[model samples]
Target: MVWAFHTDEPEFCPQCGDSLETQSTEDGPRPHCANCRTTAYHNSGVMARTAVVDTDRVLLIERGAAGDVGAWATPGGYIDAGEPPREAAVRELEEETGLEAAPEALTPVNVGFLEFDGGESDVAVNYAVLRSETAGTVEAGSDAADARWWTRDALRADLPAEKNNLRAIGMETLLDLLDDRS
Candidate 1:
């Protein structure tokens, strides 16, 4: 299925075993296999993140896998096919931090595109809600090494290091949005 392909997917056609060539399309260059006339379209991966807010603090997860290993970011991951973004955010939050958040309690905060070094890319949606709306103790699970609360002041004091040792996109943008909301 189309969902199985990444930005840097195989250069050979899945259907015909023929080498693929790059062809410019409206979206951009895509893999085209002339033998089978198959165009491997790479869809941007859908990801979701949630900030479990406790007054001035928010829950952060230390990634145990992928690009940001050991770096703290809000709880989140790629959304499963057919899952709604809000539900995905809540699911990821629970999966990473052991916190159960109501899907309806999550409010959309921000959305942005992320591209990785190996050509994997994602379009992430961020959500947030007060901690009172969620229930659970903080425990690292899934692909998280550590889970804990972090204050905006602490985060602002030193920008989080993500890919390229830059500020974490989720935290930076979500914090700015929180500032605007307050």
Candidate 2:
């Protein structure tokens, strides 16, 4: 997706708005706003995620509502204001999957950037990794329709074709980590 900066119009200076023009720079294209003499861009929202892997199977939550409904995704959600991402990740894991997790058990896995709807407002940062066995019984609530553990093959077969914000744990990465534990 194209990442463009923006700024408010002259009359609406100081308020957030689209940029008027794009100027090329060494870094890349940036929006230049004479009104505030600053650059404008939408900072990707930070989301906390946890990949709960048990044995050779990984847990996936089926979304029940908007923003990728019926798609299998990792346990996570947007970090609330003033809350740390790690804490948010753990909280979301438990709330959505009914799995209590310690903050340290969740290792940083990968960060993916995805743009949707023609970049109207497409930006997200996903922080995740394999979680410890401390995670409790699986529960389905909030925006999840169901929760289940799937093998790599099962996941590939079950995943929907159209998934916008779906975040699935990498099978190879999980397998490597599990092998290390063994």
Candidate 3:
């Protein structure tokens, strides 16, 4: 899990095209561009995931693209420019599962490092919602190759998998937390 995601900071100044040097600032050491007199700060991308749960079942999606292709995860995607996290959760839920949900219906349940295909630079702000809050039947769409609901036992059967799943080191703990919550 300890990967070099942020180690590839800017090697050269974006404006002056000069080699950048790590200079100490009040904030900490950052890539400093002397010619342009600016600091380059690479920030993590924001992602939103929604756990559409109803008592015993929660909707999950199979990754159709990068990261661990075919791994199951809560329906989610990157937040758009200027979009709120709650709205992004709803949008991602709809895009991946073909089910519509209101932003207000989502309740944030977790916020932590989520490894997308891009590594752990993208942080996940996750939400949980009841199935009754969603509209329409389930079907895979967008970046999801498969989408379906899973019970606790059904979810645990193939878990602790060696993939890009968060907490891949301890899926049993993840299952315990999820079970306790939903």
Clashes of each: 0, 2, 0
The residue pairs found clashing in candidate 3 are none
- Work out how many backbone clashes candidate 3 has: 0
What are the per-residue Cα lDDT tens digits for candidate 3 across 1-182? 11122436868777778988999989899888788786777667678888877777777888898757878888888787779999998888888999999899887676767453434377888777888889988999999999987777877675547642544212443454457656
Please give each candidate's TM-score: 0.80, 0.67, 0.76
| Best candidate according to TM-score | 1
- TM-score of model number 1: 0.80
Candidate 2 structure quality by residue, lDDT tens digits, 1-182: 23333222232223445344565677776565555555545455566777776666777788887667877777787777788878898888888888887776767776655555534332233444454546578888788888888776676576656742353344455445445543
lDDT of each: 0.76, 0.63, 0.75
Worst 10 residues of 1 by lDDT: 160-169
lDDT, residue 174, model 2: 48
Per-model RMSD to reference: 3.3, 5.4, 5.0
What is residue 11's positional error in candidate 1, in angstroms?
Answer: 2.5
After superposition, candidate 2 runs with Cα above 4 Å error: 1-41, 120-132, 163-182
Better of 2 and 3 by TM-score: 3
Q: What value of lDDT does candidate 3 attain over all alpha carbons?
A: 0.75
